[model samples]
Target: MFHNFLVTTEHRDFLRFLWHEDNDISKPLIDYHMNVHVFGNSPSPAVATYGLRKAVEKAETDVQDFIYRNFYVDDGLISCRTSEEAVDLLVRTQRILHDNGKLRLHKFSSNNREVLDSFPQSELAKDLCNLDLCNDTLPMHRSLGLSWDIETDRFTFCTCKDKKPFTRRGILSVINGLYDPLGFAVPVVLKGKLLMKEILSSTNSLDWDDPVPELFKKPWDVWVQSLTELEQVCIPRQYSDHSYTDSNVRLVHVFCDASKDAIGAVAYLQLFRPAGPEPTLSFLLGKGKLAPNGGSTIPRMELCAAVLGVEVADIIKEQLGIPSECFRFYTDSQIVLGYLTNTTRRFYVYVSNRVKRIHSASSPRQWTHVATEQNPADLATRSVSATQLSNSMWLTGPPCEILTKTLPEPLSCFPLVEPQNDCEIRPEVTCIKVQMDDVKPVNHKIGSERFLRFSTWESLVRGIKILKQFIYTFLKQSDIDSSEAY
Candidate 1:
């Protein structure tokens, strides 16, 4: 059930004239203060969305649960094990949206003939299947942009053959044509994205539909041809069948890895069956990011991958409706592991912020090391042909044999490294300040500014202290050498 919630006057508290909309060119010239402030796919709709969801919290039990879990920014999506349950959910959900959230539920759809029969066709959105209307006809519905066959209960793709030339616009048309929001096609699609990057970065002024350089022309055409076969690749809509639901021993394992060209993460539901076999896994979702033009080193990229894993894991945790303890994150980089495990080691701002976010979603104990060879996210960082992605275990999990092997887990607490000698200088020189008699030591102001680098006066005093210490140490060493000579 997808619905629209009115952004009410309650959100406009002292926020009136501050919001304005430009007049349509053909319409009146006066600037109009817009009442609906949450338009244009803006982020502010979240504030109103939360209020509506919260309002529905105490409604009928099933409706409350549906409102809590299924709604995303006002669009509600849910699946039921049975048509009877669907009817109950549908009716209750409709009432809760209207009565409590003051929302109107519309655009309803389902494969079950009985479920659709209950609602007036006026209340339902037109089916995209382009098929004749009937009680028994199953239509193709788009759930969150992935093509879903209501009859088959599998995920499908809507593809169009690109007859356009091998130009910038043509390449973009074909690449953008792929609608794999769950990233099932990413390994295949990334090849095209990287190719597009090459073409765009090659010449800033290239016309949108102009012919590409001879180099990319062949590869671009080949990739476009491969896109049609993507429709042949269908995934089960649900991660696991209801009859085959995972036991409580299931864990959400998120794998992160990076290459110089890209970083990616893939999540899976690892289900441990009681039959004494290796834990099986079902692919939940995957994410990928191209390396920025301002290049980042491999370790930093790996850290970026780890941060991405945390975000993906946290999201899957919420969506899975599972206990938070059941979430685990894996990364192949020892550098990232050290950063995550070390409580005492301070890092540069970039690393620090990422580590903080990772720690926020997962405990240090939940982070485990996985061998690069065993990391499935490696496929995400590198390119894979459509055929390879379809057959390979990367989208799922590592093979069963690899999963059976035990990893030598790193210790949770990293021991702080001692200084080079008996010097009092800090391990992190940039972060620590040298203690000195401040002309007014005990009476220093409460909010005095701290400096990462020394000022001129402090530098002079610091230089003198270093020199004095060096001279004294040299004289002592000379005396010791003279005594040995005598």
Candidate 2:
């Protein structure tokens, strides 16, 4: 159609005007023209000229009318023999009118004059003309718009203005638009084969489930293996150096405490050979129950308990055969250690003094900190229900039978003695025995003294009468009469 129109003599002048040059056209348009008409090297001059002339005449005569009539149809359909011919005519006419400023308009109307007036100004009109020419080269049917469907195996295109039959070229164009810029430009006929190859290649080359191929043999793995080897080799040697022989009885005494909230604490003491565990005899000091006043602050209580523990250890060393210089102490209380070692703030002078004494006495003993979790003494300090306490005792090594039975009673054979006058009495007393039972024979002699023992009702009455007469005689000698007192 374009070739035939171009060859017609009468349309030659119109074509020149459409190209926007009486003398020369833009390089792009000239290239477009050369490619379509001459570069393909087809020997069909008459066919090309005839097509071009007809296209020009149709564009000049009725391009607007044809577009208006077909704008609403599926694919913007028209009665023209071919869509290509219609597009060519529309492009040529728009180009001519736009360059001459004849197509510039502000509105569209049925009247020819109104339609002409609606054409844009010169520059904008030229842009619209170029768009129309481009559209002519890639003529889009209104019905051939793009559609994507993941479920379908094939691409589909339908008219943009109305639903209509699909076209192969339309679908190809749509697919190209979708994938071309993403670098997949395989022709549609071969797209399925390419897709299948991609899928198979990925599946064959890589195992999705075993994604991390290097983790099993990576640097981290190698480092861990090296560490394990080092630990296995070194730990025994270290232990051997510190181990005790009968001739060199090294002692590692551990002190620990448990609390209800935080886990527990342990302290260690190391003694040299020949000295035996008795040198680390800090543990021999009797344990004291923590005062019931500060239950809420476990850390504070643990700290205080640790201070007491160290004090006890120090006293045991001095009083027992333990040499303070040979002892090495360990504790879970960082706070107590901090104060003792001057590592933290000190608040209690008494505790600090006790710590100093322990430090001075135990020349070989060094105080070290351990995490509460590793502290075994934790079991002793924390309150446990009877059952839990019983279970814990079983776990700890001891006179193993103590786990099954209660703690053994300490020896207390002497008769019950009244608190001496010089001694101040404590507010409460806890003793296993009181004076309610049968009187045991007393071995010690007493100086001459009046003594009353009430064994029955008659003896108790007689004793009261005798005590009342004595009190009456004493009062009369001191002063007032009995008659006035009653």
Least accurate stretch of 10 residues (summed lDDT) in model 2? 230-239
What would the TM-score be for candidate 2 when compared with the true structure? 0.24
lDDT of 2: 0.36
Instruction: Give per-model CA RMSD.
Output: 8.5, 41.4
TM-score on alpha carbons, each prediction: 0.73, 0.24
Residue pairs that clash (backbone atoms under 3 angstroms), model 1:
none
**What is the C-alpha lDDT profile of model 1 across 84-169, one tens digit per residue?**
98988888777776776566777777767677767777767577234444745577778777788888877877788538777787
Worst 10 residues of 1 by lDDT: 416-425
- How does each model score on lDDT? 0.72, 0.36
Candidate 1: stretches off by over 4 Å = 1-58, 72-74, 96-107, 117-125, 128-137, 207-210, 242-246, 272-279, 343-346, 401-486
